[model samples]
Structures are given as C-alpha cells and as structure tokens.
Target: MTQLTTIVISNVKAADETDLCISIQNMRLLRILSIKVTNEEETLQMDALSSPPPNLQKLLLTRKLEKVPQWFCSLQSLTYLYLHWSRLEEDLLPHIAALPHLGRLKLTNAYVGKQLRFGTGFLKLTVLWICNFPQLDEIIIEKEVMPNLKSLWIDSCMELKIVPMGIEYLQNLQQLDLTSASRELKNRIRNVDILKVQHIPKRYIWK
Candidate 1:
C-alpha cells in the first residue's frame, strides 16, 4: 500500500456528524489534512484525532467547528492554515501567533465576534487574509507582532468602518488589499488613514 501524505475530505454529507477522531500519529509522513462538510447542520469533532503526525504542515477545516483542536498547537512545523465557516467563538489569534514557523493564514466567515486582535510573536508570518466576517468591526494589531508580514487582505467585512489599528507597526508590510469594504471606510483610507499606511509599496482597493 502506498503511504498517503495528504488527506482531504470535502463536501461529504454528514461528515461533521460522524465521530472521526482517528489518530494519525503513525502517519509520520502526513503533511496536509483538509476536511470540509457539505451540511452546515453537521459538525466534526477533530479532538478525536490526537497526536497528529510530526510533519503536518497545512490544515484546512471548512466545517462548522466550535474551536480549533488543542492538539493542533503541538504541530510546530505547520505553516499554512485556512478555516472557512468554522464559527469559532473564542479568539484563536493568540494561540496561532505562537506557531513557530507559521507563514500564511486565511479565515473566511470563521469567527463569530466583533473584533480580532493580534499580539506579539509572529516572526515568520508573511501573508494574512480575513474575509466574510460580518460581525468583525475592529481589528487590533499590537506592535512587534508579525514583524515579517508582507501582505494583508481584508474583504467582505461590512461592519469594519476603518483600517486596522496598529497597521503602521508592520514595518515589513508591502501590500494592503481591501475589497467589499464600506464606502465610508474606503473614504477614510484615502483621506484620514493615508498617512498610516503610506509606507506600504502596494495598495489594492476594490469597491
């Protein structure tokens, strides 16, 4: 039997209702695992899968999970993460920022919150994207966080009325991409917030 390094389950009906906590610790070569359900009513309890493979680098969850599995924090080699419509209530940024080598992160309608804050210690991060989070009105970025970040994208956040606070601290940032933002927010960026991100080399704004 050929050893499988990547496993992806997408659009599987009732995938979330199934108890799929299989242990993959023996799959030492596994690097990517993605599970996406077709029905929003179903949920997957990934906590059943304890002790992930050491080489796991990318994890994508498209189901309606409440929170990220604690076991994920142990995957030090993980670099890219994408969560779509996970409906997480708690802020996962703090735990995510602790990832030693994480580089890119994308969230689409994953959070059920009004704000998202980024603290310190994202040394290797270079790209970030957040989209379709309706309740998210504010984003706070503390200084020294994501020092190596170069590109950022925010889209379809209708409630966000202004640019993220502390964006100026991303000294290495080169691009800021915005789409489907409120008109007022766009106006502020062009007028009131221009100086805040004037240093960035590229700006892409789409109405």
Candidate 2:
C-alpha cells in the first residue's frame, strides 16, 4: 500500500516459510523488497524469487547470503540492488550489470566469481559500497561507465591492493571512506574526501 519503495528484513529468526510466502504474496501490490539475513535456509516452496513481483524497482539484501543464484540477475525491471556478506561469483557481477534498468549497487564481502567478462554498464550506478572482502586486490573502474557515482565506501578489506589507474575517472565521487586497513596501495586518493588509516592520529592514549 506504501508503493513499498523499499523493504528490509533484518535478523528475523522468525522469518520462516510463512513470512516468505506472505512477503511475495504481498509484493504483488508493492515495489521493493529487502532482507538482512543470517542464513539462506528458507523453505524453497515459499522463497521462490526466481520470478518476483515483476514490478519491483529496488531489492536490497545483506548479511550472510551465499552465492547469488542466476535468477536474480534476470529481473528486467529491477533498478537498484544491494547484496552483501557472501562470496559472490565474479562472473555474476557482470550479469547483474546487464539489468537494463539497474542503476545503483552496494556489494560487500563478496568473492566476485570466476566469470569476469561483465561490464559496469548495467549499473551506470550513482552510488557504490564494497567492504571487508579478503580477496579484493583492486577495484577496476572503467571510464566509459559509472561516471555518476556520488559516494563509495571501501573498508576493512585486508587484501585490497589498490583502486586501479583512473581514480579520477569517476568524476562525481564526493565522499569516500577507507578505514580499518592494515595495508595500502594508493598514495593519494584523487580529488575526493577520503580517509586513510595511517594519516589519522590515533585517538587512544598509550604508555
């Protein structure tokens, strides 16, 4: 009834089959769906999102999800997505990129699968966030796509080495937060408001 522009379910141990069935049953009259999960063990008979509301515009999910099944990337009307806390196949990232209306994305703790041929074109996104992934070496930003990003959060990623060659390519990037890092790969973070770990003085008093 709210046009349901957004819906997020967080830490609902009670998010059982009935809840899933009812949510989808509810989506027929809504526009968005989100779930913050601790596990992906919902009963299949009820949690079939392979074909969703068909009118959804935003779908946000976070926390402890496994590899994203391909059915998710096939949504033609989905324009915004947020997937966090899993080892996402790299190849699938590009598949999500192909959603014709996809516009914004936020990925954290993902494994970006074996298939790497995808493009950032699907998101031509205006905002992005990636955090705490141990395998990320560098983020590859292509100039021809994603020029509208306004904010990016890349944090707690131990293996992340650098932020590619054209840090300046994202012309509109405004707020960038890079924190809790033990190693760094870039000397300057272009022309943006960014925080580097070593540069900030430690706040605690130590003997």
By lDDT, the best candidate is 1
Q: What is the number of backbone collisions in each predicted candidate, taken in the order shown?
A: 2, 7
Candidate 2 segments whose C-alpha is farther than 4 A from its true place: 1-26, 38-47, 112-118, 186-207
lDDT of 1 at 99: 87
- The sequence of per-residue lDDT tens digits that candidate 2 reaches over residues 110-183 is 56432222245744566666666676665666655666666666666656655444445656666666665534
Query: What alpha-carbon RMSD in Å does predicted model 1 have with respect to the real structure?
Result: 1.9
Best by TM-score: 1
TM-score of 2: 0.67
**lDDT of all predictions, in order shown?**
0.84, 0.56
lDDT by residue for model 1 (1-207), tens:
126789887665544332444535556788898888777877656665677778889989886876777776787999999998888887778777788989999999888899998977778999999999999999999999999999999999999998899999998999999999988789888999999999899999998
**Model 1, residue 187: what's the lDDT?**
87
Query: Model 2 — which ten-residue stretch has the worst lDDT?
Result: 198-207
Segments of candidate 1 deviating more than 4 angstroms = 11-19
Distance (Å) between predicted and true CA of 119, model 1? 1.3
Give the clash total for candidate 2. 7
